[model samples]
Target: MEGDVWMKGYFRKRGARWSFTLDIGRDEKTGKRKQKTVSGFSTKKEAQAAAADLIAKFEQGQYVEPSKVTVNEFLGDYMSVHYRSSVRPGTLERAEHMLKNHITPAFGHAMMKNLKPLHFQRFYAEKSEAGLSPGTIKGMHTFLVTAMEMAVTWELLPNNPARRAKPPKQQQHTISVWSHEESEMFLQHAKGVSSYYLIFLVALYTGMRKGEILGLRWDDIDFEAKTIYVNQSLTYSLKELRISEPKTKSSKRAILTPVHVLQELKKHRLRQKEIKLKLGTGYDNALAEKYVFTTSKGNFIYPQVLNKALVKLCKELELSPIRFHDLRHTHATMLLSLGVNPKIVSERLGHTSIVITLDTYSHVLPAMQEEMVTNLETAISKIQTVL
Candidate 1:
């Protein structure tokens, strides 16, 4: 003990065990004196040393009163008081599912103060062993780190146990839109989740150009095949609107459509039908076979009109102004980065050769090259909350 140290603790023994008692401080809420009793030490020296360490923490204002709140109790408070307002509805739902299915069963009953780095580390390792992806473990780690941080702010814990824990590192995955080759920076986080996301989804999910999208016809979509056949493009040639062949022979290929996009397309068709019925004979029902998208009067939606709409929508959302055509580049970049075969991406994008696809999206290929050794595609799938 130091000469200036004023010890406020005592030691005792009960049968084979040694114990120590210390007056830590007063409760901030009740203004009552607080004491701690630590028992089950093998020797008086060990008890004395432990009590001395705790006294230093108490004097330095780093000690927290022991909380009886279990991990479950604190997680409930964290979700209601913090997550409900802090995260989006989808994020909140995912978090709730994680808590109910994965976290609660693991160590939710353990007292908050009793948690240690080893507990979290072991849990993450066990999860990885059970075939849960590193991404899921990383997400869970982030949640706990945030929750434990809040627990410290609320005086429920001395420090964050999760912050000291080590989690498995996952690959860095991000979606961004780049400008024209070797030009300048463009939009970084274009997730296509806005109110007008349906049309944007078509461009981003399929690598179809604005002209190809504008020229889509009811005959081109095969509902049974779940495919969108690209045959013609609405081109403004010689200052005249003309339905011409695609830029290349490969551009007239068929691309498989995602179910989400197909469902949205069906809904869009229904809305279009309702508008046609309202207009009656004023609408050009004849254009239904020639054009899938149109104005209220069933006039064709030109490429420039769609471009203007995209620019205005980006401004309203405070996002970078990307033209309707840029979404095609974004789609190619995302697929290439995901380790999808370049040849397959070329076929979907209607590129004449895989070399052209490579030349255009070469920037996203280096990361995929590394992914080849890691085989991340097989490992990183849907991050299920189920154990």
Candidate 2:
């Protein structure tokens, strides 16, 4: 015998066991009527207690409907709807690659509700064992956590299992940079033959990011003030270049350039003007937008082009091979080595805080410490002689 009222739940005897069923209202996700049913209870009271617990969970908004949606399905929807518009094109592209190449292969078919912290722990362990860097695994973890948080928001899961999963610890490695002498030599060699000589010089002198340098326009440079305004970054996606605001508020700044660098920039402008005049109406004015640096045809230069040029120049000059980005590091390292205030270097590098600058260049500290001790020893010696 059982009660007919749905809220009160019902119980019936099935041979040797008591069965209970509680209607928990319609599933909002599937638009289907839902219920919680359990069999094999030893007694009617036990069955009734189980039914009451299920009802309490429903009333508390903690009940998650069993969903057939796979992690892949949720991630697909998340990317298309929740994530696409909020991030930069380059970032979005990287996220997609992480999803397709790593995440989707591992957990795509697993049901969202069925995913557990153990599953993710195993995933991280496997990725670590396979020789993937902890930083890359951390990135994948971040993406998964974000997606799962959205699932929690949608009430598809009671909580984000990703929050409980542990990923491998990130390992910090030493950063490499060019010496001042090496940088000067490279710039000299670049000026002799490279069309991107000014771009490389700016990177080394100002520490502007690749995107910021590529986005620079003639108007953003103030010759009178000897400052370059970093307000935008040029990003490439699908073979098309577009200007976007700087990555962070700190990224938008005014950097004072060396007088010699500005003088060279003035020369560069004159050279560009001469080329434009020679091309007449054939110049790609629509693509250039008065950009401070561009291809001979007046199109914005791609990042890959800069990297290839730097590689070729280094090989030709028999210089140590380093990435174009190492130039920015070279700029910061040089400033720190010269006893320039770290805060000033931080601002020039567009870092959010001086702590980031200090941490990133901690390797340079031992040399600075030695110089400080030497200066202190000299001062103390003078005082001792006087005494």
Candidate 3:
């Protein structure tokens, strides 16, 4: 092609068949001119139509150069060049973990251009047969879809095959929450470990995520106003702790602190001060970082540490075991059960929308509905008796 004009491909008769040759472009890596040739067309018109279609695709920038790049190679390049710095460290870590453990193992050797929806369907079927949870399979599907989307964007593939594949349907599980009695019993047991009590209390009352609770700084708390400002979260990666922004815009919020919870926090601060004074220079200088929750030596608390502590406490108390996140759910459930407005509960839990709060805690609504019906019946009966 020259000066935005379509180049006419050469045609010839070869062994009673029509043949055509067209120059597409130069090799991206070697900078050599590349051409495509086809033979055995029954008629000249057939060869001409094929050549015209090819030229049109090239002109529209939709022509994908033939490539031997494997899915693994493309995924590695995509993660390194397109994904790594654009997302939070924790998200990047999860993506890398999923790619290494699941996606790369299954499809890495397959040529990028040869991947089809059936290949992905078979992969999902195998995973389902192997008893992988739908959630895990869905995560893998998301990662593959996103990677393939970038591949299409880079013109490494004609289109994203993952988009056409059917991923496993996400299975919703019942949201588990602690009853009032269970919450009280757990807190009673948690008090023995003074270091973790405040953390658990904050999670239970404020519904802050584990990372957000760990990320708290003394300056984020206002004792007189009984408000806690959540602006960041502490994330651990490669055994190093770093502060990151909250998970969503709503996660960056102010939570009204209960008076009793504030008192406990104040006492916890005094205890930390005494410990710091006793340790003197032996204290970890990192404690000066001013995280509200820390190790006995004054280092930032890790999520795993909190989880382990919660697990150990549950085992000791012989209570139903739940993840640390269950405390946040328990808080929302308790609030909604007490006739608290769903919007307020949504804001307290830092949900992006009331729809999420409703969907997540829909199991708790049946009881609320029953209560509403009973109240309506009672009001109507009182009016009828007056009449």
lDDT of 2 by residue, 185-233 (tens): 9999999999899999999999999999999988999999999999999
Return the TM-score for each candidate structure: 0.49, 0.84, 0.84
RMSD of 2: 3.9
Flag clash pairs in model 3. none
**Overall lDDT per candidate, in order of appearance:** 0.79, 0.88, 0.86
Could you give candidate 1's per-residue lDDT for residues 201-284 as a string of tens digits? 788788898778878897899988999999988776444566767877889999999997898888878988998898899998
C-alpha RMSD values across all candidates: 18.9, 3.9, 4.5
Ranking by TM-score: 2, 3, 1
Which candidate do you rate higher for TM-score, 1 or 2? 2
Task: Compute the lDDT for candidate 3.
Answer: 0.86
| Stretches of candidate 2 exceeding 4 Å from the true structure | 1-63, 125-133, 169-171, 286-289, 379-387
**Is candidate 1 or 3 superior in lDDT?**
3
Q: 2 or 3, which is superior by lDDT?
A: 2
